[model samples]
Target: IAHGEIFLTTGGRSMDRRQIWSAMKRLCQKAGVAPSKVFPHNLRHLFATAYYRVYHDIVKLADMLGHSSIETTRIYLIESGAEHQRQLERLGLVS
Candidate 1:
């Protein structure tokens, strides 16, 4: 568990789930956003969504996410619908 820090705290120690949740809640409040919309898993989903948008390769995304199946990584793609349409429009493949 070297460094034991997948997510670090302000004091440079590993952050517990509760700490991350609380911090996210606080940030959401300060931003005047719904706290329910902010969670630790959302960060992973955002990263996966951005990476997939650039690569457009699910197999590679699965590898990066250390997932045994692409289906698991697929759960992270929240922008699938609108982003797909935007890509099509950008390519002039559809009006």
Candidate 2:
């Protein structure tokens, strides 16, 4: 299978959101992490946020997230509040 191809085959059917969430919860429990802190949707958010942080390229991010508009990606993925404040501080712009 390729990178994006689905691997599991249950009667040649695709896994739904509940199955994915349950798997994530089980994995998180095994790893000694709170399941609430790392749900499946949270993983998607983390991916978008991390990619944006590393590249700062909204166009690429929008494409990766399958978003039709960069504006939607920006609203969902842009770091603000405490995270934004910390980033500014790290860059010596908050002194």
Model 1 accuracy (lDDT, Cα): 0.84
**Over 4 Å off, model 2:** 1-13, 93-95
lDDT winner:
1
Q: Judged by TM-score, which candidate is best?
A: 2
As for candidate 1, its clashing pairs are none
- TM-score of structure candidate 2: 0.74
Alpha-carbon TM-score of each model against the true structure: 0.70, 0.74
Checking candidate 2 for backbone clashes, the offending pairs are none
**Each model's lDDT:** 0.84, 0.80
lDDT of 1 at 49: 84
